[model samples]
Target: MDLIDRYIYAVTRRLPTEQRSDIEKELRGLIEDMLAASADLATKSASGPASDQTNATIRVLKDLGHPALLAARYRGSSQHLIGPEIYFLYTMVMKIVLLATGGGLLIAMIVSLITGAGGNPFTIILETLGSLISGLAAAFGWVTLVFAAIERFSPEKIKLDRDDIFDPLDLPEIPAKKDRIHPSDPIASMIFMLIAMVVASFVPRFVGIFWLDDPASNFIPLFNSAVFMMYLPFILATMAITLTREIGKLVSGRWTLGLALLSLGVEIPSLILTIVMMSNKDLFNDAIFTQIFAWLHQSDPFYFDLPMKILVGRIVIGLGVFGFVVEAVKTFVFWIKRAD
Candidate 1:
């Protein structure tokens, strides 16, 4: 029975998502009917001994052929460039690539605007639109080409929809509800990562306070732009690593011990980078403190002095470490419970 369930899972998971439920029902009924027929035939024959249920099940499965072959039959025919075997993966890849492309281009536009490299707002808007269209087209074309080639030429292992050897025992276990990943989770994670990347890349240029009453000079940046630029690479790298982890989760569509470990691995580098950036005292703009004192029209109190800046940085570092630990513990605990 577990073998049958696994077999159904194996075959159905490879087919188009919309066709899976109906095909699964039909396949289950067919397998059951075949088993019943075999039982009746065995009874009529008065075989030397009762036929083994496992043997009968195996016989029926073998007679039906390999799961991949059966799945192909259910799919009917493939006239499209990408066959149904890998069509779902192809589409999913396309979606993720397009999203990444759009986000990267938007970040580039933000950087340009912040640095005054983009001349006029109207011109920048038009340029961004043109770039977005071209970037999306390129992403679509390249992703489609790769998946099409994989579907047409790659062996079963590479295509990920076929089995080298058809063994019901080797079929993957159906994931428990707690272990399953919802699409929204990965999508949201990716969106958050993109936003973080955009903000990190451009914050050095514009993160500050704007004065409402002062007409001459209205804004004071909070960070030393030069120093912030020096740390940009590490910040972007951290974001990229986390983004890759999210993509892995999306592709896997379930939590595993490996994925949990990978998340912790990614968190380490991210935490280290964040701590480094936060601890760098030279990165903050001293002028911001002066402006704040001027606005309050009072001498700097001890809590608002140079040591206060160091204390604030230490607090941020502590909070970051605590947050990382909480997330890591939660991920591993959930995965362990699900495994049980």
Candidate 2:
């Protein structure tokens, strides 16, 4: 291509379409005129008029950053996922997910060693791989889901907003709508969570009444049976919603009801077992909680030993707190979507 043409392209690349043709024409004319003027000015020299149009074009290109940088000037701020913002988010999330996956495997290895899960090294390695794969997949699944959702529903896609650079004459004032519509309002979520927290804080008391007198009622296997009674609210509250929402949202569109059913299904079975064991006096102390409690009773200043007696208050109040939290999240998400 000609020196003038190359110079024109380099300059025009940064300009928007509206001004590109005009700028290209102006640039082309300027380069040609400058070269012609230079030749006349250098009539006395062997260096030959600023070293020819090619040399002048090379000098001009060096002053400009690049075709991409030039294009960016007229384009203004961007909303692309591959841009700086996404890179930042991806870097952060990647760090977290990788840590989570590694931690899961590390925990699995430690537990496997303690439990003597398998007799052979091969089996242990196999178990470790299984645990690692599951953890990584879950981490990536949620991470992918996050980016996908953000891409689909980012606020920039909504055309109702006007650019900040506005002219009063171009924009007429329209009366605002009475309703303020937004996606996932945090205030509503906070209120709902607070209510759920209150509810979960109390449910165990009501539920624990069923377990009151049975001698076998307190022994819990993986966790303290009394923990089931006292903090059932907290455990069920967090787990039910977190598990259900994650699982339900993964499988279906209707998450609120699925989470509700999931909470009931998950929470009720254990509650039933607790009630049955409590009524039958089949409760056993959690070896860990028992040991810890024994140590605390012996070591601590509470001049009294905390009776390992099944706590009616703990069960009722702890679960009440948990249930209240999960329900609150569900209700908040449901209503916000409904409003939208």
Candidate 3:
């Protein structure tokens, strides 16, 4: 019974979350039918002790074959950018490359801060953030390109991951409830974080106020460039921490006490830094607001004064604090339940 549950979990976990529930039901029905048929066949042929039922169950499972292979069947195709034969190798190589890239960029950033690189601190931080983003992206891209090429071009004779020969007995042990992780979760999070980091690092100037009737050249940036650059280092720090957490999940394929603690450790400081950055009125482009008022053909009003700015900052800080609390609570709950 546990085996059947494990097999179903394995097969459905590989699928999209929206499809998992339907597929799980389908798998259960199929397994039940197979077992019933096997029972009837065994009854007609011969009689035996309880061991016969156990043997029948094993036979049905073996006939169903490996969970990965079954999942592929349900997916309707076996093709992939990187085929099964080298997928494990691809992931391993990717982890190594990403780690190396992150570590190198981090060292460079620290050195720049210490030695007072040619530029001011704000400019130096922006540069480091850009370099970090580009370096990690390049590493990810090159490794993936090479691996996909290998998967496509390699000789037919080359195979791995039990591709040439597979055995149901080789099925992995069923992980504990807390230990099971859907690969897609961490992967999707990483993609989102990467996009956010890129926008923050390279495209802050493009984030601006624009008039629908005017040309793009008339755009006024939302934040003073110099002031924005000063906050880039904070963004960089949070991105690094978030990326590290996701990578840990990816590599371990599960949550651990260390990972949970790492999240809380970074989250508190990140929230503080975010609040400090958001509360700074100097970051807002005074010229941009003046231009906005001029374009509206209205004089500056008391409603758009210091108190208004303080109100907006308070709203942002409130939302940020709520988010931080939710994330912290989730981490603590998961860790506590798993520990129990």
Best by TM-score: 1
By TM-score, highest first, what's the ranking? 1, 3, 2
lDDT of 2 by residue, 1-340 (tens): 3654665676676676798998677656765666666556556566654455456566555555466675566466563553443455545554554564556465545544434423355776776677567656765666556655544454443332345455568542342342222213322332243334333332322222122234433322333345455654544455334432333233222334434455455555445444544443234344534545555675432544533434533464457556756766766676576466
Model 1 clash number: 0
Worst 10 residues of 1 by lDDT: 154-163
Residue 1 error for model 3, in Å?
72
The stretch of ten residues in a row with the least summed lDDT in candidate 2 is 204-213
Q: Tell me, by lDDT, which candidate is best.
A: 1
- Clash number for candidate 2: 36
Residue 40's C-alpha lDDT in candidate 3?
76
C-alpha lDDT of all candidate models, in order? 0.75, 0.49, 0.71
Each model's total of backbone clashes:
0, 36, 0
C-alpha displacement of 160 in model 2, angstroms? 9.1
Per-residue lDDT over 190-223 for candidate 1, one digit per residue giving the tens place of the 0 to 100 score: 7677666656755654577755554443566788
Considering lDDT, where higher is better, how would the candidates rank from best to worst?
A: 1, 3, 2
Superior candidate under TM-score, 1 versus 3: 1
